[model samples]
Target: MNRELPVFIRSLPLVLAGWVFAPLIPAHATELPLLFSDGAVLQRDQPLPVWGWAKPGSQITVTFDGGTAKTHASSSGEWRVELPVHAAGGPYELSVAERGGETLRVRDVLVGDVWLASGQSNMEFPVAKAQNARAEIARAGDAGIRHFKVPRSWSDKPEPRLAGGYWRAASPGNAGDFSAVGYFFARELRTRDSRVPIGIVDSTWGGSAIEAWMSAGMLGADATVAAEKIRAKGAAAAQAATQTRARIAAWNTAPPSPEAWAAAALEESGWAGISVPAQWETQGYAGMDGVAWYRKSFELSAPETKGELTLGLGQIDDSDRVWVNGQPVGGMDASWNVPRVYRVPAAALRVGRNTIAVQVTDLGAGGGMAGSAEQLYLRAAGGPLRSLAGEWKFRTADVRLSSTQDDINQVDTALYNAMIRPLQPYALRGTIWYQGEANAYPGAAFRYRDLFASMIRGWRADWSAPQLPFLWVQLAGFHSGGDTAGESPWAVLRESQSAALALPATAQALAIDIGESNDIHPRNKQEVGRRLALAARAVAYGESLVHSGPVFRAATFDDTKARITFDLQHSALAVRGGGRAVHGFELSGADGHFHPAQALIDGGAVVVSSEAVVQPQALRYAWNDDPKQADLINRDGLPASPFRAERTRATLPQQTKQETR
Candidate 1:
């Protein structure tokens, strides 16, 4: 009816012709870079997606083996074409053609199983620094094992593709760069089955909060997430404004007189005496906050050689600004979790006795210098320097500040947008996670289990693989377990992790015994990997091997005695500490006050009884912040998972449903 309709409609044919004939333009005109290229395995029975970008409205065609498919680029310049499902075989070639007569060819594409390995720093930890890394490196020459590292990024909006990365085969030269957990998991998978090509995509960021990895829309959908996001944003903004104002005020203030500072450095001053490498709270400075200054003087050699100077100041809490001879050498902010190593230029060093000063700022919890009691040395260029960590002067300063809005926004979704979105669409066999350490605090981890499940479901939904295997390591025993029977956040989080197995095709690895009481990052990663491998064998490889230790099944009580049965695979119940009586059993009556109960392993069940809990209504095992006495192991040498049980009709499903509701 419109006058221009006929002319517009008439031009449609020409537009179609242009779109059809656009392939003669140039090579790479319609090609987009493939992500998760390393060790990528196509699902055997699924229509595999081979997607990328090209010129808008470009005619794109793909050819692989003896099959071909075609699709046109959309207005967004993105195009995707699905390859027919193939069997578990590879070493094939793929070619993509687009407008401008350009063709992009990829070689050595395989069909098999792929996996997405993700988590925190523990998962991001590279194999180069892992135990026996050299030995592992020697055996890295496996063409069957492939790896694709997702480049780090974050966005508040959900994205379809990631920024950068490609696939590479595992070799001694490249294995060092692979994620240790992913490499180990893939190694085990390959060892068990050599016919399939295994691809592992590493997409973990170090020291990232779980919220950062979640989609912005998902976070917005939940009221709790929304509230938490608001609170966190407000806190971050307030902190940032405070820090900015303080920095400006400090800059405006008169600079410290060099002579006065030098004289003060010489005098003992009123700096409180505190041991180096000791937490401030432990050193009688409890509840005391702000920046604390510490000083130490060391006599240097007469002739200071001009060379590289190494300054090792162990570690500082939150942030630190270090000075040597009144000159700022180096500083670190919000990096207290790791030791600081500073390479000071020789110009900062002096010949005679020099003063080394450090100002540490504590934001929360334990503050002050930390780490091994190794000597802090100052090395000269190509020469040895003096040890400076032994005995040094100390001082304290009070300064209150906070972070800025930009800082908060900078950290938001930075991990997810950069690390996760790019690895999407890559077919994977399963997933393995090792986190929850960052979310162990009280009240913070309550929703973590749901958040974790949501993340898993989100990934599965995104990948279109509903039945993909999902396995994770339960929180291990840590800290010192107190005698009192009370609610523990770590235990709750572990229970949450265990409950996540309720999702389809999921498994958990119990590592209660493999953890170190003194260290949160346990050194025995091999056991963790092997245990994860066991879970993979059962869930992913369809093996009938005993993959788990003992999981609590049911508990019944009669008068004063409670009979607790378990689902132990491959072995009978056994106490790990060589005692006839089992440990970590606590029975509680209607008062809800739990008391340590005597326990004994009979067959595959444990009988718990206590005079204090004659009418036992509930029982808990290994339920503490740091469970040191937990020795409930099975005959297979695997530790039992921590759990809390009640005699009431509340079952696992009901509990989960109630929690969700």
Candidate 2:
């Protein structure tokens, strides 16, 4: 063999030597993974991976900014090459090419620190949907900043790659859909180091649980879906169970007219056209139950539809059945939280036009495609990828399926399998999470302690960053003033979130002050973002600034009053309101009846006394669902987290405690 022979020519000797090999690379060769496209930001000061599918065993090379990395494609067609650390700067081009194959050039790739912003509805709350989005949207242009939203995709099993997605640059047009917390965080990071290009990977799901974000290995067999469902508080579980049983019974008794409904030739003139990636509630069909059908049409050229294909519809709420070109392809009976990735055999696809029909049945919560708009797509089985988001026709019957809605939020590791797993192995500077409302279900708060800590541990292990700086937002204030503070589940949940601080290099972005009583998704996400940014400075960037409010470190009590000490450094304790009396304190006697206490600040400590609490044995601060006046601060403008003293007997929710009894 000639020394300068091409990869294919050099491999001829191995083939003649009777070496077993995978199928040869197609004419269309190499490609970057879903997260490695245009405007993607590589983590700075870390090895940058440029990975994708290449010809099996083919030589692949990635070149960027005066550096190059090379590797051979594995038998499975997977190939990866790591470039040396590239500092924070780029409008540079990333070129990935395969020997004797195709080339991919990702334009506007930047070398910068990357952070994963995640959690439930609050984190997913977009800038456009934020309180002051219009003003923010008007000024939302920063080419240096980019966002890669891992379109919501939940799975039962871990996926090697995202079906299809891309990195979107921040702009007036795109920022509206970007996570307000994430966008605001990135924007503030610009203030600290404007020169460092920043990228935010917004991977969040509205109304999702902390468990849904953990991997299967972390959750184990018979996952949280089975375990937590047993501990599910409130009447929703029983109602859903009843409705599900009846729905299944009715379906088994008489299947609906699905054939006619899935027919491609059916006229849908009366059907309403709606966006694919939006929830039905937001799409004007709130509180909808029973069944609905959605259809979208896309084109495929002569050569394009010949090969095997895959359809990525992100994730749907409740249940869904999919059809391609009037032929049934696949479906999930109860996969409310899992992403839909259906494989379409070549025979099912036509050469020119294609129709994708999805029939969804929602028993509860939000409906329709509850996943990301970015993840919906049609891609060649092992080749080029395409986007299948945008418009689709939807129709629903007036009949309600049942009195209960599906508990999709409890799906086991569904979000982790689809969204988090694929992004793994991508370097991360750290993660910022905003969640916990979902875990406030009665007795669920106690369970949150172990699960929350486990999630942080597993995520760190997954990212290969043992000491990764993980920052989270404590549950914000909500509901009426916790007059029944002892029994509020929200209070307990916040305590569990604080318990995770036991882990190192972790901080909580105190949100007890920024929360709204009437709204779970508060409009003051700017403060939330700013507080998180402050934590990044101290915990992640090692800055010498105060990033947290006063945290309850220890409590000492005299026969009459209690003094609470906090972990503080250069910062001093202040009453936050012109030295006014501090609120959100409670004192309990041996009888365990907690009474509102009068609190005042005294040199890094909060002194509290309650006239009603004689011989105070316990103390609590901000111990309520919504402490309207929990205004303790550390002069840093950051608010203190809600806390309950050990001496105080924490009350469980009335209904929950009674039920447990």
Report the number of the highest-lDDT candidate.
2
Task: Please report, as a residue range, the 10-residue window in candidate 1 with the lowest summed lDDT.
Answer: 11-20
Q: lDDT value for candidate 2?
A: 0.74
How do the residues 1-661 of candidate 2 rate in per-residue lDDT, one tens digit apiece?
A: 0000011111011110101122244554676666788888988999876678877899988899879888899998888777898788888898888888777888888888899998887888778757788999999988877898766554445667764457888899889888889989888898899998889998876667877787656766575554354234224434444443443332222125787767767777867778878777555553345567888887777676678888998878756888888889988754455678999888888877788888886644567786776679888755677887888887774323322122344566766766788888888889999988877766677678778988999999987888898999888887733335347778778888888888998988877777776557677888888989998998999999888888777887888888888877578777766775898788888887789899988887888999998899877777778877788888777778887774443322223452132
Positional deviation of 469 in candidate 1, in angstroms? 1.3
Q: What Cα-based lDDT does every candidate model obtain?
A: 0.68, 0.74
Stretches of candidate 2 above 4 Å error?
Answer: 1-28, 222-406, 480-485, 647-661
Report RMSD for candidate 2: 17.8
Instruction: Report the Cα RMSD per candidate.
Output: 13.7, 17.8
TM-score for all models, in order of appearance = 0.70, 0.70
